[model samples]
Target: MAVRKIEHVGVMVTDMERSIAFYRDVLGLETLGTLDHGNGTIKLAFLGSPGAGETQLELVQGYTGRLAEEGKVHHIAFTVDDLDAEIARIAKLDVTFIDPDITVLPNGARYRFFYGPDGEWLELFQPA
Candidate 1:
């Protein structure tokens, strides 16, 4: 079995439109596409990266039953060229944030989280 590169990261959001705005407008990530997976069971939105498709964010919604509450996922972080710039961009949307600025680590990388709708944590970090 050949494993492929991560196509996108799946995030569970209680509110699709609000989360879309948070990721698209606030973060400046371009929208690639969105799809309704029939019977109102699932909704998906694909977000493109600054480099015009280097990465993506798959926004998933409308699924109930486990993993909807706390402790399921602590956070989901996306790598950025300039963590500071991305942080500032999202801050404009006034999306609730944790450590609004980049926090330095001993390894020389930085990180921060912008709390999303329904407590879905969104993270921006620079990898070493």
Candidate 2:
């Protein structure tokens, strides 16, 4: 199978407005659209920074009945001209990063791990 690109990352939050405010207002991300999944009281807000989905952070509310895992996500993302610089910027955010150094994945990709507010595992890497 050939994959074009990652659509976006999904985050399950307890409060929709709060999450949106944190990301959209505080983080300065732009909201693309929102999906209201009525099966439950879940809603998905698609957002993008200047980099678009290459750095999209989705806010999903009322799903999973729990928050995302704390470390080592099911999917990891890596996008940057300089990984080290990006890491440094993220570090300044007062975020709790798991590993600030480069990591070797089983597929032989180099990555770094960080944790999101809701316990989401984020992997930042540069393609070989």
Candidate 3:
């Protein structure tokens, strides 16, 4: 068997429009399209930067059960060229940051955590 790369990451959201706006407007991602599954039991909206190929963030709607905890499968990280600028942009939106300061890893990478529209943990990572 062979593994190439990640195609996309799917996130179950409560509201489609709000989630779409958070990713599209706040994160500066482009909406590729949407898909409906199980006769509308699930709706997915694909979003990513232009020319990003198969790497995308899939926002899903329709599930009302319990969600995963913060450090579990509910977290997603995005690599940014300018973490400070991205954080400033995100501050203008209605998002909440978990840490008041950016965390520097042992390798010198910087990262900060924030919550999405649905309380999903999102991270901004900057490589050293």
Best of the candidates, lDDT: 3
Which candidate has the highest TM-score of all? Answer: 3
Write down the lDDT of every candidate, Cα atoms only.
0.69, 0.63, 0.73
What TM-score, over all chains together, does every model reach?
A: 0.49, 0.48, 0.52
Predicted candidate 3 versus true structure: per-residue lDDT over 1-128, tens digit per residue: 12234445667787889999998888899898886754567776879897867567878788557765533244566777778888888888867999898987544768788988877777776756
CA RMSD of all predictions = 13.8, 11.6, 13.6
lDDT of 2: 0.63
Count of steric clashes across candidates, in order: 0, 1, 0
RMSD of 3: 13.6
86 Cα displacement, candidate 3 (Å): 38
lDDT of 1 by residue, 1-128 (tens): 11123344667787888988898788888777777754657886768766775557878787776673654444566777776777667778887887646666544657777788887776776755
- Candidate 1 displacement at residue 68 in angstroms: 6.0
lDDT of 1 at 87: 66
Q: What C-alpha root-mean-square deviation, in Å, does candidate 1 show against the real structure?
A: 13.8
Q: Which stretches of candidate 3 lie over 4 Å from their true place?
A: 71-128
Better of 1 and 2 by TM-score: 1
